[model samples]
Target: MLDRIDATSITTIQLYNQPFIRAFEMTPSLPTFVPATQLPLAIDNGRLVLQDMLGVGAYGSVYRAIDTQTHQTYAVKSLNKAGLNSRQCAFQNHEAQLHAKVSGHPNIVTLHKVVEENDCLYMVLDCGMEGDLFYTITERGGFVGNTMAIKTIFSQIASAVLHCHSRGVYHRDLKPENIIMFGRSVKLVDFGLATTEPVSSEFGCGSTFYLSPECQGGFIESVKSYDSAANDVWSLGIILINLTFGRNPWKQACPRDETFSAYAQHNDFLQTILPMSTELNEIVKGAFCLNPKKRITLSELARRVQACRFFTTPEFPSEASVVSAATAASQASFSTTMSGVYPTSNLHGPDDKEDSGVDLQSMA
Candidate 1:
């Protein structure tokens, strides 16, 4: 089941502002997500040439590849049938389904196509060359005085998560490792643990450090179900804390854990462990409520993110975006009461030239 077709030199696409919302209205959702074990051999797309191995994981490896004709780079993730169990295979299938369902989201990595080869499933994805948010945290040693940077990254994640939920896809695993960087822009990747339905007791899947309290195995006696959407939000909160503080606040998300325990007790941990901006502080506070029902919904979280007074007020992409040329550029900012530092408006944008002026909104 392999077909090779000549492709044109398709430029790497970048979306900015609200226009990105409807950019892929015609992109079709995939019809099937069959397991690799059942696929025919040599399901490769010969039109794309593989280069270096980008990453290795439990399920498979990702390679940097380029289209032969277009020469555009893509990430090819190979999921071998041997690396997955029946349940894992099913989850993998669901992951492929969910990703195709939300194909054009700017903050979520794009999947160009799927191929099966040598009993392996390959997902061609966006090449995030800057690596992941986790690497940046280690390099920067925390956001430090850059509150605007913190807001921008967190808001992008929040908006993406909310968008997925709205489309009925629950990204059960959301962590720094899963958030890959595309220059100043970030895209959520590795949807191997994602699903279109709620996570049942049968599967409590996520990295321990970023897992929600309800998803913890030891936290509950019998296997139980969880609202994976909340887990996504909770993990995003942890990611925010990690970015702000430069380390894991707690060993785990359990009440018995030191940091989480303190959070459970009058929310002291948030204030005690890390010093952050007021807006970030409140976002973290709402995320660690321990009660899934009370935890801030993604919609509300997004609103709270956009409402930060630090945001100067988003503006249109000005004259540059409207040009017939290949790219568009736009930005806006207002005076801030806090010293000379001004946080640029909007959640996703180009990298800040300096701490004094941070423009987090996207540039077309």
Candidate 2:
């Protein structure tokens, strides 16, 4: 008789190798590009011409291209024809259509058009030349400590999420990698995992680490089973922590047996970042609550952040200042803020309204 491997030993092995396993496990499979025949659009002198490949995903590759006719740059996302053939193309098409519908918001990446060419579906969006927040944070050596600057960025993201929620669009994936920053402005990109209806499956689409607790437990069971806008808020909270700490809060949590529920309830894990500001700590705790109902909504979170000790003071020089003084002050302020000046101001107008008509509704 052959010797049997002990289950307990296996568990211990998995726990010890959890980090490596998670890295491999969360990585999506490579996409299979559709045959050229499925591509319906032709590249001409005055049409679309592929510039460069930006990234690849389980669906397909994203290409940076130029529209010769309009002389405009765009990010063309091509869906793998092979995947489309096996899976539901309707959902992909729906995602593109929904993005097109709400592409007007400043904080949301604008979708120019969609064209089918050679068995591939190509979606054109404004190309962000400044790259994504992930790149910025990485290049800057982790977290940037400009409180006003960070709040400014978060406001833009919050505004986009709120707008999406109001329009019944749920962005299942919200992370720093999906947040593109151009100069001082930021926009939310990628809607591959977005839905206009309620998300019904507990183990639905999302990056593993960013997946909400409810989602990890496989609690979602129906198409209308989504947790409203709070899910996005939770992801945003995680993103905030990442930006603030320069790492994932659950980076040490093993993926094999440490489900999101267990991770959320562990107070020891929560206490790991006790050095963070009380405001930020509270924000993080409130957003990552195990119960979706307990998590604060995007509107409420935005208000809290805006009213926090950040975003109150003026950093840049005003337009009314004289040319020489304004230029000097602007340069100084920019340098100081960029170097890490945490301002404390309640950046709220007299009205202090919650939803300024920006929607964050789910598309599924």
Candidate 3:
């Protein structure tokens, strides 16, 4: 189902199990700019008519747009250039380049084109009419008993990540908010924080709940670099938990978080606190392993996910027991040497705590 975009140069990259064709050429040089304060009703010389606002962010908003030429619909992400600093501008360019590299994958969002003008930058992408995974999960109250659905959705997401990795792209900010859906099909989006570097010293560069302990840093005092690929794997494990339960295992992955501390010390801690099957627990354990070198690779993870049939225990944990385990774990001794991070309010949907100083550079 890999759809190749029409491009001039075609190259192949070695994937974990096989070779993958990396199509899509580097985009043409950015076009000349025309300055203006507000979004244009028509862009690309009236080819696209901007419609309703789909969502809004600090620097920009996404709008539903229609191509007058093809009569096709798209989600246009419009960023206000006046609000972005030099570094932010560079990151925006980098995001487009990295996203283009991984665009052809079936499970990843297609970046149709990049348009710049009138004090703003616009990215025309496939519209996800069903909204994001966060809203979908919240509406359904998690995929706890839906094993088949979980398998299908998670596998697609994994495939998308694998595809990105095959292209030397690491999506540092991997979370439910960045995962959109068109019916049951998943599309990974937002590559502003993504990097081509296999390893990065950019600690605290992702959402708190999804970041690995290494990425969170502050444990050993001295600076340390982390494997970005492994960081992505760790985020996937958290995402799996969110899909199985309606909630996150913890607020953050750092040792300072009581819930995460309990899981780190005891192998069966997750089961003690939640209704998770041993089979699914093993997968989470592999992904959450403290040692980045030993964390399961994306290929191995995809294989395990495909093989796993059960994701939750038949009997759910009692409310009292869940509370008791959380209470006891609150007293567990964990490294107190960690940097202060804003609490990640909820995993399922957006909350008022978004601007509460997350450890990432930009949550675009």
Arrange candidates by TM-score, descending. Answer: 3, 2, 1
Q: Is candidate 1 or candidate 3 better by lDDT?
A: 3
lDDT string for model 2 (1-364, tens) is 1223333232222332232211221121111244445443444333987755555544566666677777787777777555454446776687787787678999998988788766677777877765556544444333344566667778898999888888888887787667776556778877866777655454535665566756655332223344846678878887775555344555322233332324444533333322355566677777877567778778888888877773211321231122334334422433222211100011112332221110001100
In order, candidate lDDTs are 0.56, 0.56, 0.66
Q: Please identify model 3 stretches exceeding 4 Å from their true place.
A: 1-39, 83-86, 218-223, 317-364
User: Which of the two candidates, 2 or 3, achieves a greater lDDT against the reference?
Assistant: 3
Model 2 CA lDDT for position 30: 19
Model 2 alpha-carbon miss at residue 63, Å: 1.2
Q: How close is candidate 2 to the true structure, as a TM-score?
A: 0.69
TM-score of each: 0.69, 0.69, 0.76
lDDT of 1 by residue, 208-299 (tens): 56778788753434335777787788887777665554445555666455445555554644553344455666777787667777999887
Question: Candidate 3, residues 106-169: lDDT per residue as tens digits?
Answer: 8998999999987788888887665556544543333545567677888999999999999999
* Top-scoring candidate (TM-score): 3
In model 1, which range of ten residues has the least summed lDDT? 339-348
Which prediction has more favorable TM-score, 2 or 3? 3
